[model samples]
Target: MTRRLLALSILLCPLLAACSLEPLINHQVVDYFEANDIASNQVILQNILRAKDGAPLHFSELASIRGSLSNGASVSTTFPFMAPDHATTLPRKLGTVGMTITSSPSFDIDSLDTQDFTNGVMRPITPETAQFFLNEGIDYRMVLLLLVSGLRSGGRPEMLLNAPNSSRVVCYHELPALNALPTQYSILEADEPCDGQSEPEFYAFLRTINHLGRLYPLSVPQPPKPVGRPFDLDMTKALTAVASIDPGRYSLARLASGQYQLMSAAHGSYVILCRETPDGPAVAGVLTSERDESTPVPVDACSRKHGNAADQHASGDPAGAAQPMMMIGEQKNTVVFKLRSTLEVIQYVGQILALQQDETEANPQLPERCVTLEYENYKGGNMTCNFGVLFHLQRAGPAFSSPLNAVSYNGVSWSLPAPKVCRAPTRCDHTLETISVISLLLNQNKSSKDIAKTQAVQVVP
Candidate 1:
């Protein structure tokens, strides 16, 4: 009986080795990825197998078996010792294994269009393209998942991928390079601005690719919905108010009721008050000389034609030459300019303040109903007069309030409910004018540096 059993074991050994060869090969591949700390590669292999065969083979399951075998706790480890003849049989079976592997498929990496995987530029991967990568032994599914994660995470793939050129495969070799780079992927967090890309636009593009369902088999998670603003203020009035003032000379704040508050750029300067009147929302304040004494006002030739005191003075008219005087008390107490409509204010202020002196020369007629000032004289007597009496506040034309449409000025479109202020009132410590000046200086400096760098590069050649 013992001789018969030994003879039977010899015959059955080769068959048993053949049966165990496939699992051993799979275990070795899983061990290689895990030992090398290549989790991405391991995932790719599992995914490929899952795609080819309907069975889901997890690396963790293989890892657990490997752990048991290494600790001498698994019964399968003794199979090799029980049948030494199986080892001789394995060498002959390798050819069959190689044939099976080669028969799976070979991918043409060179055939893939270089443009499809370029960083920053999003393009859909065709089903054929994905299959080609898979055939090349590239885990295209893993590649797609990592790509979507990097993009959604807000990391610039250009920075991460570091391909030699736009037209190149973002390879498995390149995947390890990301570990050295900063993990941040969101465009918003990047110091350099992306071409006005928002998070929503990026996710929308991802969703488009996901719907194609060729690159990645699984569905990508949807991005969170953006929060909406609670209220929309009439930005026309605020924007008009801001544009009318010399940019650095004034600051604006939106009130809770959607009205705006204007204040002088000077620290501790009182708010430029606005009142709701029967005429409309009118600004109640006095236009006082910034200086205590009269200074040499630079009046242009066109302004002199307006016959205002400042213009006369500049043109050598004796009456104009007489130093423009103001009541000491009334100097501090200016007039109320009524708000007709936010758009109309710009036209009204432009004419009344001689901002459009050229237009004043063409048709010089002061409006009868221009801005009015009401204040007490030096003798403490109440008085009221048009701002035109003191300064050349010319009228442009009929009020612009009639045909209400969008107002475009200085390259900004001021819509009815003003676009939300870029900075909240509490955060806007610096006057808009000051911020504009700083921004201009910074931009000019950047432009100068860029020019200098370009010149240097050219000169080096």
Candidate 2:
């Protein structure tokens, strides 16, 4: 009797488990083969599935193997391996069909919680307003379904009412399944009427919106850098006016009105380096080669012309212009946190002199300082601030290019020792903006292999 019961149990197991076959089949259908070997398996699975459960067969499988091609479509095989064949189901081109979808930049599509639709005003979900998803063109049926979903949530009634007429609606007579399934659906055509715009025009607007949204998501916000307090130093009383300037720098931030205010004070640079922290600023150490004061810079007509003009321009100004074509001295000062780690270096000796020539042309009253802050490396608990460096030229000068000195972070003020003078500081002027990019190859702790392979070479006479 026990042996007979064991045989019955074994026989009934497959029958009892057949009710939950989808999960079992799903697991069993997967084959661990190389990517190149998937085509034959796909064809085999298509046949097996069709025979087992009357599933629809995709055109590509039916065409070569079964000699059953789509009636109105042409198939073009680009590769031996797996590739999707494109097909059109339109019976006749009625003028031109067009559609589009759009969304607000502040709206989060993935997490469409109650808050997103809480406002009384329903944001348009048309192609003109869609910005969340990456794809620009969605099927007309998909557009209608999404609008229906929005309406079901009591979000936008108007959007649902005009779903058929949306600019990006794509009309299709018949739609096939994704993986050779027999499922079919129809798309709303673009000939439908909108209140003011034609179907094609509406579609073009939606297409533009979709393009903008893909390039710039609606939900993501512009990253705001940490705010650094304004610099306050008694430059007139405590600091000596005759002190030598080791490193030349500046920073700027935009106000609500879209105008950038500059901060030129040393304390501003310090605050930018140590944003929000009680500690003032990080020490920046200047890297320079040993040199005496007697070492003279090269003399050229180009450097002399603009270099002299820069000094003349700075005669009455608070901070003087950099000498033209001259290599400036280097110093190491601590940079605790200046906003972003990278600084942008512009190749504009000419633009600088032009700006000096017409200060009014480029905002006459430029701020002497600016600050930027950035958060980076956000993997759970690991985060760091990236300080940006921006440089603007005081005036246009000669086209002389050479390597500038390097700096590091020390405990005290930017420790810039052995300040190397340029050939002409006035002719080759520069100022740092709020967004500066720095080179990491010069980092002290980088690997030797990295230094040897990707390091930048310094240019010095």
Local distance difference test scores for all models: 0.26, 0.23
Tens digits of per-residue lDDT for model 1, 1-461: 95476556655655554554556556654554444333222332222224223343222211211222110111111122353463555422111111121112111112111232121012222223322323443233222322222221111223222111112222221211211222223323324354432232222222222222222121111111112222344665556644676735544433344433443343221112222335543222211112222112212111222222221211232342333322211222122111122112112223322322332344434323211111112122111122212112111233422112123333433222112242332122112222222122222222221211111111110
* Top candidate by lDDT: 1
Q: Which ten residues in a row have the lowest lDDT in candidate 2?
A: 335-344
Off by over 4 Å in 2: 5-121, 124-461
lDDT of 2 by residue, 267-322 (tens): 21100001111342211111111121111111222112323211211112212342
Q: Report the lDDT of model 1 for residue 360.
A: 33
Against the true structure, whose TM-score is highest? 2
Q: Looking at candidate 1, what is the lDDT of residue 185? A: 32
- The whole-model C-alpha lDDT of candidate 1 against the native structure comes to 0.26
